[model samples]
Target chain A: MRSTVREADRPWARQGAGQHEGRFALLLLLPAAVVVFGVVIWPVVRTLVVSLYDVDSAMPGSYPFVGLDNYVRVFQDDRFYTVLGHTMYFTLVSTFLELALGIAVALLLNAPLRARWLWRSIVVLPWALPTIVNGALWRWIYNGQYGALNGLLDTLGISETPTQWLGEPFLALNMVIIADVWKNTSIVVFFILAGLQTIPSDLYEAARVDGAGPWRAFWRLTIPMLAPSIAVVLILRTIEAFKVFDIIYVMTGGGPASGTQTIAFYTYLQAFSNQLFGYGAALAYLIVLAVFALAMVYLRILKQNQLAGVE
Target chain B: MKPTSPSSGSIAGIIAPRPTRRGLLVGGSALGLSGLLVACGVGGGGGKKGGGGSGSGSIRALFMQQAGYSEENIQEMTAAFMKANSGIKVTADFVSYEALHDKTVAAAPAGTYDVVLIDVIWPAEFGTKNIVADVTDRWPDDWKQQMLGGAVTTPQYDGKFYGVPWILDTKYLFYNTAQLEKAKVDAAELDTWDGVLTAARALKESGVKYPLIWSWQQAEALICDYTQLLGAFGGTFLDDAGQPAFNQGGGVAALEFMRQTIVDGLTNPASTQSLEEDVRRVFSSGQASIALNWTYMYGLANDPKESQIPGDVAVLQTPAGPVGRPGVNGSMALALTATSENQDAGWKYIEYLTSQPVQDKYALSSLPVWESSYDDPKVVETNPAVVPQAKKQLGDMILRPQVASYNAMSQVLQAEIQKALLGDKEPQQALDDAASEAAKLLES
Candidate 1:
């Protein structure tokens, strides 16, 4: 009888060992999972849930569930549409300009210049500066009265009158875009420069031997090789440009008749200004959707390019 | 391990052999259940702890940025309040004035802040939502009367007081004395819009880019310009019943005057979209010969470190309109929250901050709402540039309409005003459409 009891206890001991190991594994993973859930997943879930309610942030716990009402309201708002359009317009125009200018600058810097390191370091200065500081600097540059741009134009005899760059509704958006491109093009330049360094010099030599023009060589050899880097730059910049808030907020506050209002600014206004949390959450989701959609398009293009390369 | 299911064991054998297995299974299940329960308990505990600490513990106060007030002044005020009231500790969160409004509105529902300092115009919008407490019966009668007359009135909604006026801000016309002399236009002649425009034209002919610089973009300045001109034309924005009255004759004439000023080039095309701060920058940078801005700019414009033309600045009333002189009076108000645990303590802090003595100490930093403080010798000596004009204008001041729907209404009016300025729509059409939209917002 005593031997049978001892034999039954063997399975229990093995089971105890298995359970202890399982608990130990869970303890290690639990902390990381908690952190991820707390910081990332929870906020996303809360935002989604809040988006379904009509929340007036001024009244605590007063938001009653109103399924899809906030979403519908956001879609119907003319300002929403206008800001969304401006965001798309800003992202598309600025990203394209940054890519083109960045490539140009990178190509120039990649050449065997006399002081290549100094030139490269200096080119990175704009990108290295803080965004708010850059915004304030650009705001000073665009001032109608004492701005550097106007002063320069005045000195050059371009116009007797100073240009109201930020004050004009038509020009304010363009001025902000110009400032954004100037500051961010350096980032793209750095990426492209890295990509350019990885390309084999022998490919260029072969193109030259084949009597290829500089433009032809760039299109066929350089660009094709730099496709991955270009894809990364486009995706990163597209998402960033779509969510631009600080620079525009500081420079224009979506003013001169909301001409410069972007989707991000509109979301802030809805969330913080109007205290329409549900609507703000819905707008936030819309912005996420926009970025995701653009990412998908870029990913598709990248995959197609990869397929072409394989063929 | 073994063929365990062959036959049922006798009761004594089964009971004696299964103790280890039973103990392990029970312990493992108990631990798993306990872990799940602990995870579920955190949220409820956080809420209870937060609510429990509301009154006796520390409270957070959100304040708008003061133009010339330093962080040290804020610290001093907080220390004084804490020292006087030993039971409560206050923490101040200062943000830019524009951002402060949005922050308070957003933070209130989350119970993230216990007290908020708001613009006087904001209480109407916030009051209707019941974010601010009604303190009509809570305040002392003498203290209420001691505030600048219309300043206290701006925080009332439907005959109930929701906030206490803490500071006063009024618009004043700032002219360059040297520019007036250079243009050879008598400063005394600039009492009316036509007179000012004529002087501006003379100054423009004298090579000044913008002779009259004022922001028509949005906010209080727009309301001030509109009201000053409209009241001169004997116009009112709303009737006795708080309905739209801007479609009347006085309103049309006022809008036309603004348009003509832009068309005639007396005021710059840029002024149509410039803010008060932008216009102030133009003035401080020595570009504008004349500008209309708030009283706070007087200190910065006179400070040699910040301003190129320090002593050259002088203040006067906004140019009188055809019918009467209407100056837009702006004020900042402080309100305690209904959710505040320490209501009496919060009131005491408000009293201490707005007391005549404390207000006098901060007079140079911000315009005091206390009438007694304005009369203080130190206050008069400190803010000499516009104190006299501010005092006089306080009597004739016209506040922007404090309606429940003012926020939405202001946006619509601002957009239409911008449209009219840009020549996209006529003034009448703009006002009519704005009125229609405002009606919709009000009804909704």
Candidate 2:
């Protein structure tokens, strides 16, 4: 009976020790969590709550609860659906091109080259420029007449006439994407280059010794090892592209008949231009859900690749 | 990790585990709850600034800094106003024209500004929304009588005056005299759209790529052009009930004329994207034979430093239509906010700014609404190009629809017209669609 009582007391003592340890750990994490919640999570939660009601920032205390009426209206809006489609289309096409170009550039940089540091720094210049400045610079370049691009084309005798790069509806999105890719591909290249560095050079040497060609060695050794990093880059680029607003707003203003209006631009218009804050919030949440879903898909792909590696 | 088991007990003898998981769960929840509490506190902290005491004793005037004006103008105006009124201090916030309008719309109802300089079109919306004070009771009979007829009529909403139009603007056609001579077309004959089109064709046949140039792209520019044509066609945006009636008759006819101009190869496809500055560039570079823009372009077009076609440009009223050559009125009006504690001081500042003597001083940069300023020798000499045409167009100055949702309604109409110009939709379909959409917005 004494032994059993002692055993019972030992577990209680251990639990108290565990509780102390847990409290210490929580205390260490509390500051960071508080900062994040204050800056990010709180706004998101407030936005979610506000989306369920009709609220106007102009009339602060006049908000009345309307349940999910805003959300229902958002789904019913043709503009919302159109903008969402544009956003997805932009993300898919731009990210695909960026990944391809980024990987190609990273692979080229990985090769034994002269003045490697200088080349690497030069390649990163575009990504370092501010987005708005980049947009303005590109707008000047794409000017139909007297633009550097048209000047170059004219010099090369590529065409007899200058192109209205931004004015034409069919060409405006592509022009914007070109500007975006020019500014952002360097970032993706940096990530891919870092991932390339993590792969063991000895593995490539072994593959070469086994008579594998350059293409085979890259496919078998390089790509498999770089899958995880690529996954991260894909997720980040997709999220960023989906939230694209500044460049489009500055360049086309979603004009020439709403050809370039993306979900982000549409939300901005609804909130600030139209002063429909509730509708803006609802549209924002839809974007959040879409991005989260894509991220989950990428995570599953990462898990599968990792499992295959383990096997 | 091992799965923990619960203790089975009898009535007298039972032993229980430590229940660490449940304890951990409660602790975790408490941590999250504390985080949420901190977040709520942070959000709550930002709201206090909104409830602070309203500004008193000093009148805050929000004004636009025109492109050519310097900060000294603001200092001088504020100092002069303050010197005249010793009891009240004047504080002025200067912003760009576009930004001034946006900030007023955002901050008016929040009582951020005591007085504001609103673009003339904004009164229709701001007045109806109760963001501006009704000045019918405060304005002196003499001051009201001194204003231009059109200027006084601009700010009336529901039979009450909400603002005083202090600065006026009108659209005019700026033709290159040299280009017309080179094309061998008489300038006097270019008084109608057809005559202008015929001259433009001759100019184009004489090796000109873009014969007639205008900024027909942005919503404002489109509306200005439409206004000139609509007036010529005897069109009105509103019926007696104040409902939009622009879809049929003259409105459609005006739209068709614009479409015809685009199709006839007289206007550039790129004009669909051009703004005021771009239009100025085209005319100033001598690339355009004729340009339709505001009267202010006269000085710019004659400036050798800016314009290559100096001494070769002339300003005239936009060509006559079937009914008449109607001009669109673009003006900036001064208003006291409904929340202003210093309404008297605000009104006094506006009076100083709009007085004939001060108007003469600022005449080069602004077209003053004071009837006396039009006849002032100093003003006449300073803005000669505009003074002549501006006086003539004053009686014919047609204000756009004075509806509360003017911006939204205008945007819908412009977008549809833009689609028609771009060949995305036919003229009738675009007008019908725009009318339906505008009706929905009006109903809402």
Candidate 3:
């Protein structure tokens, strides 16, 4: 009987126990897995399927599989390139400005001062605002005949006539970027401040002892120390900036001769407004690919910085 | 705290028992039960098969959330409806104009709405999708005489009436009488585009900043304005075979005239970004000497609360075009969903809403589609000027291209016309581009 019991409790039996544990873990995760599959994976697969067809929801079941035709058409369309350029312009300009201004604000908030907490909280107020609300606020500010910006300029003797801020194409896009920077820079500030707190004072003290000035110390110490955080912020902001829609929709509606029409807006026009479901799906997938490429570039930059830090 | 030894009595044994599969099963089931409850709560009520009643069942109607279709106003109308049909209950739902098309389309197959407010452009799509009911035989023989010509024709598709026109709308020339008098321009002389330009120039000389303001924003409004202009030049958007024909003949002159209006500084350059409401604001602020807008703006422009120059505003017949006076038909209609089980009640509600009495009351906010409503003492007392101006422009009104691809075509036209207006493209090139783009869209 003792020999039988030892044989029953062998390593094979332990393997069975491990399998049971794995099954139990899978059972526990089944609900979450199902939810994710239903919501995310299924939609993505459906979009890919739809992108192959010439579908209009208005005419149900009549869609024929066009097999890469939509993709070819999108590539051929000059407007697609134009709007893509607009998207890139918006993303790069907004992200660069936000990062530069965000760093300065983060350093200011990091300094020891009275009401430091209050000032830091205040700095995040714009970021906390809803994007649609931010867009509406900016639209009103840029209103041609009666706007706060025009009023201020008139008061300051900047321009004699009420300037139509959104009436011009290039200027309208720049104005939209300014509005985005105002709202998004605070997020960068918050992240950098978190990164700033993680840096030990000993490093800065050592820098000072080594006879480094504030500027040199900032370049060598603060920026390098904030690299990981900067990378995280840059990745998040770049992705968000690339997919910018609500702000542009509310502020410009891709107007002034389609100068402000971003790729996302163009996709929306094709899908919802024009009801070209198949083409829209293809355009959306193209945007996804573009965003993925940008993410890869960001990752490469991050990897290089990490290697430099290790050195 | 209890002190226990691991060999005899561990802390796990002392405090509580170890969790078992049975416990986890109970926990998981509880979580699942809560989730099921949420799912059930969300999924319930929507799928309750609508009970078709015997002339008294509840039917839900969806309306675009706008001036005349606010919740309060709808409730008032519903109260009146319930009063007349004591057994029937009308549930009114409001969706914004932006979401109306998609929401109605998505829900139509399931009969989510009993009665849908159909835009002037959507009857073709609705008819093709079998989303709306055909009510051709339902109209009385005198319907043509009773309703305005544009209103009667707007809801017809393939020789069947899919809807009943309720909100009669057309763009009209609303000029400030004081400003016109100041510029010494006779209202009769403003019957043609050339005459309007002369008056605008005179108004500009009289210190009117924006002598003409139009809803020229690159949106649906822009298409409405363009349609009016195109029709004025005796140009049709589509040919007999329903292909894009706006590139030929009179369309070029129409676009050139639009471009020249801005080039000559008669209209505001900022009008390129102005919507109907924005144009109304300019007119109401006594800045614009003349404005072109929807019929609803008449009441708002003359409302003392809404307008600074309420006493100075007056309406004129739309300017005469090369063909005739040109106005684009923009009426919204009340349509029945094909899937609605409560078809009888839905029909009753539509009949009630579009009835002469209700339409007269509606005339207080928007113009009534019924020609007879103009003769009502209540309408006459409310606004005497609107009826006459509307009647004068009745024959001049032209319908937008009634096609399934109208929305797409409108977008292309709006963008192309806006390009011309913004100096991004020349007039002829813009029209040619619009025609080609629209052809591709329509064929697709």
Candidate 4:
């Protein structure tokens, strides 16, 4: 230690050791940095640039630069507003239901129970399956004529006439929400459950001693304790729901009158299907700004928590 | 309880930094804005898009897997093509019909494919955008005359030949023969739209809940079905000055006729959600007695493994409306990609695939486009039931509007048409709304 420690205390030797470890750590991170730059940073920059041009074709060509025109056009589009309304409704309803159901499930799971591991494992299964698979499964189930839903309804003798689950616009959108909630609620439950465990048992006991009922305790204690987890889950689910595409693509193809068309799906149609890449790029940037605003809200909550010494 | 070190570089500050919202937003926005400006023109090459190369080399082709040539048939054809032209090697990629257009467009800039199979509706879009090579000079003069009229017109846009028409197709009326027999509806009674409705009513009375099914989903499939009916009812997509005319007269009538069938419970309510494949499955399972589908469906629907009513399936030309009977031209063609370096080789591959001998061999899967091949005893023997209808119907095919904005226009129409079918809007109002929207698209 005296011969080598000399390095720990000596400035020159310490600097040399730090340099060596820093270089090695940097080398290890190089691949990840390259991937992020290539996929995320590069595409984002290019999309922003593309949004400023009238580049219609995917092929390389001379295009007219129309700075900020596409962004202005986004506000003027009637279809854009229609799809935006749908996306907002989809996000608000889906997230609210998921949070409510997730908290309930998380409390149940957190409670002392039989086969806790087995129940926890079962709860994670829906989240384990990919969204696309879940969508296809739900689509088949919702098929109007030969779907499992109709078959089940018939067998249960609840309805004689087959309901066209994905046939009408409004009904199809709600059905898709039901499908999305079934799959995504599992993740929310896990997040809430993790938060639930961090809640001290003494808080509930003290609330009880103070003459608080179970509901009052949950409202006053459990909910306040779960704020950070709720904020985290809210941001994640909100962004994802706002950008919902694959599930809609598989289940509905934005149809029965473009009923389930989200902003992302609409952008895909503009960019790929309609070859309006410039317009699509602008739409994409708007989505980013929207998600950024949501993240801002989350960060504000996080800052508040830190200031209150709640962490 | 604890004093805070404000310096962000300190360990305590770094562990849980109290970054203000304004600072982060401003930082992120500046970073994004700087990157955007710096990256401007990164994707632009200003390079010319179309050319050809030496006549022989490796070539790749893109084809739709769902319809037209079966993937197995295509592979076999490619193998034979390569065998004959040893100087050229061929690689074929298959996607669903829904994916074919986007894949071709995405691959165009990179020159990923040497050849691509294009739907009849895409010639205008591809040709105008230069995604496909203009091969008018390469197309032989005699080949045009030798091909069926519908097939000859398939690859044409603004008087230019964009490709070689290969898979000739039109939707033909397919019905369950045994069911029609049980309903005592004569096959000849299905000749006209009026008579067809009467037959559907009789079939419905004969215990069929919905006697008619259609490929009427909110998709291009719906447009194809609509186009056939639009032509039958004497509606033109555009007038002489290129103004939208589908809102008037026959267009509204065709839509009304469609809606009336649903209101009468003759057409399946699920038709609003079904594509060609769904219609095939419904008819094959004996759930629906009548449907309109392409030539390939005849083979699949009559196969014992694919259909429950295999031996009882029958085919006929599309029923006539007040004006005439014209099936939707659901044909596709083979074209050289504009960005292909091996375009000469690609054209050679296309020629081989579209060759009369090659088409005649796969007659069971898709009928030949060559006019003379229809008369070939060998071709007729491949499928006796569909051949006669093909002979009559192929000559009378109707095309959708050939415009660069056809896809967008079709989407507008698809939505409004679905509204009418679902009884949300009246037929006239729906068509009117669609026409207004399509007019704006066409103008742009």
Fraction of native A-B contacts kept, per candidate: 0.28, 0.15, 0.21, 0.49
Per-residue alpha-carbon lDDT of candidate 4 for residues B241-326, written as tens digits (9 for 90 to 100): 88789999888889999999999999999998888888999999999999999888998998999989988898999999999999
Q: What i-RMS does each candidate reach, in Å?
A: 11.4, 7.2, 10.3, 3.6
Docking class of 3: incorrect
- The CAPRI class of candidate 4 is acceptable
Candidate DockQ values, in order, are: 0.19, 0.25, 0.15, 0.48
What is the overall TM-score of model 1 with all chains considered together? 0.85
Best model number under DockQ: 4
DockQ, candidate 3, vs. native dimer: 0.15
lDDT of 1 by residue, A63-178 (tens): 56788888888878877888888998999999999999999999999999998999998999999988888888998888776789989988899986877787666588989999
Residue B256 CA error for candidate 2 (Å)? 1.5
- Model 2 clash pairs? none
Q: Please list the Cα RMSD from the true structure of every candidate, rounded to 1 decimal place.
A: 9.9, 7.2, 8.0, 3.6
TM-score of chain B of each: 0.83, 0.83, 0.85, 0.92
Q: DockQ of candidate 2?
A: 0.25
Return whichever of 2 and 3 wins on DockQ.
2
Q: Name the lDDT value of residue B416 in candidate 2.
A: 82
Lowest lDDT sum, 10 consecutive residues, model 3 chain B, at: B41-50
TM-score of each: 0.85, 0.85, 0.87, 0.92
Candidate number with the higher lDDT (3 or 4) = 4
| Count of backbone collisions within predicted model 2 | 0
Error of 4 at B395 (Å): 1.2
lDDT, candidates in the order shown: 0.77, 0.77, 0.82, 0.89
